[model samples]
Target: MTTGAIIFMIIAMVTVWGGLAAAIVNLVRHPEASEAEPSPPVEL
Candidate 1:
């Protein structure tokens, strides 16, 4: 593979895994928020 392709692959991998890690941390910090259901819509 080309050097540019390798670099792009590394960047893409980092971005995806970083996002996943952030999501997991947020869920851990706010367990209730992830588990709670949304409220029903109000009647007019």
Candidate 2:
């Protein structure tokens, strides 16, 4: 594989793993820890 391809693959893998970690962390946190309210639906 070319140098550029290897670099791109590494970045993509890191991004995917980071997203997964964030999701799991969010799920394991207490409900009271959430402070943001859901936004209202937009009328497109």
Candidate 3:
């Protein structure tokens, strides 16, 4: 309702959605290798 509240809401929305967008872009640019083998377990 208030102007300050609206501004804060927008900032929060951008923070959340912006982080998601950045993560997606990063994943797309550096995708995981599906055919990669898992590392062998180390002996204790």
Candidate 4:
């Protein structure tokens, strides 16, 4: 492969994996609520 292709691949790989890592860290720091807020009754 060309040098540019390799660099682009590395950049893309880092972007995807980095995003995954960030999401995991965020979830660990702030988890979702156990109970969701109740929804209002629907009108006819």
Best by TM-score: 4
Ranking of candidates on lDDT, top first? 3, 4, 1, 2
Error of 2 at 1 (Å): 0.3
Worst 10 residues of 4 by lDDT: 31-40
Model 2: lDDT of residue 11: 100
What clash pairs does model 3 have? none
Cα error, candidate 4, residue 33 (Å):
0.6
lDDT of each: 0.92, 0.86, 0.97, 0.95
In terms of lDDT, the poorest run of 10 residues in model 1 is 30-39
Off by over 4 Å in 2: 31-44
Per-candidate clash tally: 0, 0, 0, 0
The stretch of ten residues in a row with the least summed lDDT in candidate 2 is 30-39
lDDT per residue for candidate 2 within 1-44, as digits (tens), equals 99999999999999999999998888888454435777689998
lDDT of 3: 0.97
TM-score of 1: 0.70
lDDT of candidate 2 vs native?
0.86
RMSD of each: 3.9, 5.9, 3.7, 3.1
lDDT of 1 by residue, 9-44 (tens): 999999999999999999888787634788889999
Question: Which regions of candidate 3 deviate over 4 angstroms?
Answer: 35-44
